[model samples]
Target: MKKIIMAILLLPIFLNFSGCTKKTNEIPKTSTKIEKSAIEDKKSKVNIILFYPSKEGSSLSASSRLVSFNNSLERTILEEFLKGTDTKDTLYIIPKGTKLLSVSRKEDTIILDLSKEFNDISTENEAVLNNTIYSIVNSLTEIPGIKNVIIRVEGKVPKINNISFENPFKRNRSIFNRDKTSKPNDILKKQMEFESQGRWLDAYLLYSDDENNTYRKYFDDYVKENEEAFAQGFISKNFTVGSYTVDNTGTHALVKVKFNDTNRELNIGMIKIEESWMVDWIPPQ
Candidate 1:
């Protein structure tokens, strides 16, 4: 009778110890599952488009990148914009040492408060100032549901030259290096045709508004100089159009053209302007 009672007591103790051991092992597994779920959330990503100035500072170039998605997505984008791009032949238009102070959204507009360095760009030159503002505006407006951007320096709107930041700035499509509607080859062919027909004004219109081009700056002088070439048929019969290759940025291209009745190939530089490609530089015949 004494042996049977001891055996029953020991059986209960063994069962209780086994139950405690199982609960301890299960605790770590449950914790591991929760940790895995949190890690998955952190790994989530979303695609975003960023705009930067072209190396020439004549137009804006669009770059697409994947960024982590979270509650502070807008802020994250602005931070990325400030960090600039690694793309060659592109420029980070934002003033160096500039910092994003804060960001908030109201309806369709996002207000960006930036450090004082943001206002230190060259305001005297209209193109430079316009490019600087649009680089930020165009970048943020790429976000869905965000139609405009309001820029502020030190919590207050700034007036730089003719541009006033008191109101929300909308995205300007004219500032982009290229749009979806045009091809570089087609544009170059059209320009050459216009030149062959002696349509000087038409050819001039095809040229980009590059601040550095003397022909664009002195339109009358360009036409006067080209008159003799047009009369001699030199401009019309110089080269035959050939194959072309565009760069990865899509803003620049190398077009090949052959000298008339010769095996000589001349490579011309083409730059995208708005929706059309414009001859950046044409070599002397």
Candidate 2:
């Protein structure tokens, strides 16, 4: 009878130990569903994004084709301004001439590294250059969050045909789309019709002042000076240019651009300056 009593007491202790062990071992399971949920939560926070802007001028068609969304127009504007060419027919190959070498995105700008063949492929013909310009800008500008595009070739900076590539324009870059506030300078604007058509060398001379803009003295002398009138007339914030062709002599162009606030359109023309690349627009302050 005493042995039976001892056995009953040991049984209660064993049951208590077993219950404690089961409680200590239990844990919540984290499976694929939980992990996926965490990842999705992280992705939801990254909605705002900026795109690349162009230093090379491209064509309107090129800009339009850069992206599908409407907000991407900023990116296209920068690109077309820099590239100064149209790239519509190159659908047989890649959309933008040679394939892009590399594309890096910064806060408000995009740095694009071009393939080696960029210089050799389109170097000879002005039409090719225009096509190239239009294609690159039109394509990239359609993406939102991109404001600037700095183009390089084979990991090196390519020189502008006539002018320096060093300057980036805030005035030009700041405004996009057609501005309702803009007007026209009927006489000067009409004189500059060809500049928008991609006459690069002629466009450059129209703006370039000899040695520190000594040419500005002639701004007072409006009759003989075509470029000064064009510069003086630029008063609006917005700008837009349509598609066109270029005649290539590998020479830099003198550009006379008149912004007609009354007409709300830019009048562009070109005269031969020298052999060099023509940058489309300088940023306004």
Candidate 3:
């Protein structure tokens, strides 16, 4: 009876031991599954990152990010005006979408690596290149360290950002002011002033005077009364030569005239000067 009881207890103990061993083996398999899930989650996180990728991406591009600095004086005109986004350590530069690349900086000048896209530049496309370069230079200057930037394509230096292969458009003109830009003719004005002052030349030179011109008749009478004294002074004084400029076209110049010390302003019609700009008073019909 004692031997039978002892065998039954030992049998129960052995069965429990086998069960525990099976569970232990399963734990390792479960742990492996958990490890695989964690690895997959990490990969997904990497794909979600939103920065401009590395140089080995679909097309290599190196663009600057506009950043802000504490030194306010270094901020360029463009930087000051276009200040909406965060630029705290970001340097703004023109964006690029090309596969080719190159960068060379010497002193204050920086040359960019260019490709075929820069071949034939258009007016609209110029903005991109200009603004891009401008942005880079502007940003760089803000560091209080660098100067301006010069861009070159295919190892050749170019004046403009892009040039057209065909005959290009004419250069646009600069704006001019009407009031301050032009100077008044002092000599012609003096002649007109003398006439208004009642001094006139000889009637012989005046040929015929019409009844219509009140000022003309007055001057003729003044000439007749003053005689040689008026003739000498008036002829010499009335020798007013108004000037007109036709510029490069050589079309005509509008000459403004004033006689003697008179404040009256007179405008002579433009004259046609062949192959050059000429201005003269339009002779009375």
Candidate number achieving the greatest lDDT relative to the actual structure:
1
Residue range with the least summed lDDT across 10 consecutive positions in model 2:
46-55
Count of backbone clashes for each model? 0, 72, 23
lDDT digits (tens) for residues 48-140 of candidate 2: 112122223221221222222223333333333333334332321123454455566676566677666555543434434544443443334
Q: Worst lDDT window (10 residues) for model 1? A: 1-10
TM-score of 1: 0.49
Highest-TM-score candidate: 1
Candidate ordering by lDDT (highest first): 1, 2, 3
TM-score for all predictions?
0.49, 0.29, 0.22
Ranking by TM-score: 1, 2, 3
219-279, model 1: which lDDT tens digit per residue?
Answer: 3334544655566444634556777888899788877766554456556677775556777
lDDT score, residue 11, model 2?
59
Q: All candidates: CA RMSD in angstroms? A: 25.8, 27.1, 41.8
